[model samples]
Target chain A: MLTSAAKTALYGAHVSLGAKMSPFGGFLMPIVYTSILDEHKAVRTAAGLFDLSHMGQLVARGPAVAEWLDRLTVNRVAGMREGQARYNIFTNERGGAHDDAILYRFPEDWLIVVNAANTAKMWELLQASKPAQVALENRTPQSALIAIQGPRAAEILAPLCGADLDGLRSYHALRTRLADGAGGVEVEIARTGYTGEDGFEIFLPAGAAPAVWERLLVAGTTHGLRPAGLGARDVLRLEAGMPLYGHELDEDITPLQAGLGWAVRWEKSDFIGKTALAAQKAADDYDRIVGVVMDGKAPARAGYAVHADGRRVGEVRSGSIAPALGGRNIATALVAKAASAPGTRLTIEIRGTEHPATVVPLPFYKRPA
Target chain B: MSQPADRFYTKEHEWVKIEGQTATVGITDYAQSSLGDIVYVELPAPGAALERGKPLGVVESVKAVSDIYAPLPGTVAEVNAAVEDDPALVNRDPFGEGWLIKVSLTGDASPDGLLDAAAYAEFVRSL
Candidate 1:
């Protein structure tokens, strides 16, 4: 077995705190600090700190960056203003999603944040698709990302940040300094998160990550902040109706099938997979993504068969016992349009037995406004 | 992670305590801790037969789903209803309240190759 894996700057701190470490995204990461339930609840009620350094960050700069990005990703990049971010996908000509990413626009460069496992593939794809005027650099090794997410995120993070976070809306980024106990560090703070809550995703120099992480935990201690892990992160994101790369999305799935049609811009002149995506949308030929709620606590896990009228109609893409939603079993699946209605009945085949489930709306849980 | 000195353990992390022909079974603390918070458990009925070292039931944790194996060939005398209703007991008290099933041994000879407490601790450490 391959024992040695990549470690983040905060690895030592996680070990000291007795975090259960596991392999994820080619790195040995904290799966949980205390328990999955407690960490998950902390994110919903108060605030939770997360180590997201395993995500891939790539920088594209120079004269033709805009045109290069337009051809590279599915979302519209030409109209994105400086300090703005757009969720996008990199796909093949067949309209299959290769990877999903968040594109951040700076004045002189574009930072594309991708899933960690797809980093090398995305880099090679961009290189092959880019024009000579564009310069590509993988800055993941030099950068670190930490997220402080929840209802109390703003109040907990306000004191240490130099930037005015009150006006920073979702998907907006600003470069500023964060005051830490050791020393202040430059960071790009973005008001965005996968947990469906108000939060900030801070990108800072890799060397200063450990200090900044410790300071954030201390600052948010009074606000009920806990060090969360990937286990909790998974349940939170699933409850929010966000799709994971390998689970809800893969090389064979398209953006439209995953209920992410809004990310694609049909008005764009040309881009990779645009032709196929336009065809798919025009014909409305793809299966629709719908939420499934089990009758009780029985969880419908990924790859479980979804049956309608005693016949297999679809398969679960992601499912979990949603903690924020009263620990109910909720799932998302790509099903036929006929069975995708809000009140349609279905059955989830788990351990060779079928359990009754109901087709609900897209997201199982939405944070109160 | 506590393991009682009297019980015998298997490489699969199950513990068995025998008294006469009946044997009580449950997973070890190391097993429950490694699996994280268990959400659901599915066990065989009281009258079902179990083969030694074969799958007996399924335990679904918040992290993943793992199969529980039978340590000795026996007939299940009783299944724990408490654990079926609230699976978190497996994490809270693995030895006492979280015991999965009580089985009546079928054959004369006990299941061989079971590890003692010390050996089980060493096996968990290697993991």
Candidate 2:
């Protein structure tokens, strides 16, 4: 199955670390190094390193870049200041999400980080919709992204990074150099992450990734920075209430339906899917995503039926044991608005039996300030 | 890890130690290791009938779930409360504390069709 999948520069390092390899987003990715629970706890408590090179990096330049992109996505792109990053979503004609992305504004260009699975689709869409003044480049293959996440992440990275780590605010990015053995490599350090913790995502050339990875590992030994994999990443993101691409947002699921109305800028003059999104927002009766906490020990899985009042209401979109929640099972389910209230009672059908579950708030976990 | 020579094993990685009319059943070490950090276990209740090669319970890890199969036809005499309460026991000691159920042997309860320890070790290698 992995014969045709592409591998990142850190693939050999992962194999040497005895990571369990699996095919994800057309790439041979590490699912776990030691244990998912251990890695998940490390990210929550101390620090965790991630090889996120599989995510797509698209660069857009030219004077009309922001304006052009603003018309394509649901968020306001042109209003973003340089060195700022914003979460946005590209929607289709029906206001359904094409993909959720993070847009980083630079002095001369814009960097859009997209989901790995949507790389090809987003690239095609951007190329097809490009105006004469916009220059679009798919830099995914040439770029590598490494994220250090946890409460102690900044402490672990401060000694090696040349940037003012203390001054960098959240949702911001700065071009800086990271010291390697021979001089250093130019990198973009972004104080942003999906793990709902204080962290930084470093982007650099693919060729320099391995050395930087090794250096970070060596420097992070005292802070308990273990190389985490996709399994832990999924659990961390889910607990943080972040919307995963295929689960919460998809071609058929709009941002509003996925509880991402905060990202949609209604004041934007014109954008793709604006009409449909406005209609849905105005109607406010669509089936939507909600958090479900299982009252029993059984973990609700994706595609499991959800019931309310003895009738099928929705289905589980994602589920996992939230180690942050003291091993309680948590899930995201798309259900009718009537069943989406915070205190609503629901049942998740696991094999042939329905287990009791209750609707709660979006995030099942939050780090201490 | 090597299988215990005193018991019999099935192709599905379940081991059974037949003692008189009773049999003690649990998953092999290879099975627990492959499953990875079991978080929950579902075993057949006491007095439940189990057919050979049929699913008797489930073992769930953080990312996946697998069904544990019966190695011999029998009625469940007792279920392991230790494993059900703390699933990590299956990963720590699959052969001892993680035993799933104690069964009262039923029809054709002889271990004639099961693989002996030497044969079972060879079978695992072939996999």
Q: Candidates' lDDT values, in order? A: 0.89, 0.93
Error of 1 at B17 (Å): 1.5
Candidate 1 has a TM-score of: 0.97
Q: What is the lDDT of residue A162 in candidate 2?
A: 91
Q: Residue A53, candidate 1: how far off, in angstroms?
A: 0.7
Report lDDT (Cα) of residue A320, candidate 1. 83
Task: State the lDDT of candidate 1 residue by residue for A1-369, as single tens digits.
Answer: 375679988899999999999888888899999899999999999999999998999999988888777886788888999999889888888888889999899877888999989998998988888898889999988889999999999999989988899989899998899986766988899988999888999998889998999888998898999999999999999999998998777778888888898888888888888888889889985777798899976788889999999888899988888877777888998888888889999999988999999998868788999
Give the lowest summed-lDDT range of ten residues in model 1 chain B: B104-113
| Winning candidate number (lDDT) | 2
Candidate 2: the clashing residue pairs are none
DockQ by candidate, in order: 0.73, 0.78
Give the local distance difference test score of model 1. Answer: 0.89
Specify the highest-DockQ model's number: 2
Q: Name the weakest run of 10 consecutive residues (lDDT summed) in model 1 chain A.
A: A1-10
lDDT of 2 by residue, A150-258 (tens): 9999999999989889999999999999977679999999999989888999999999999999999999999999999999999999999999999998999999999
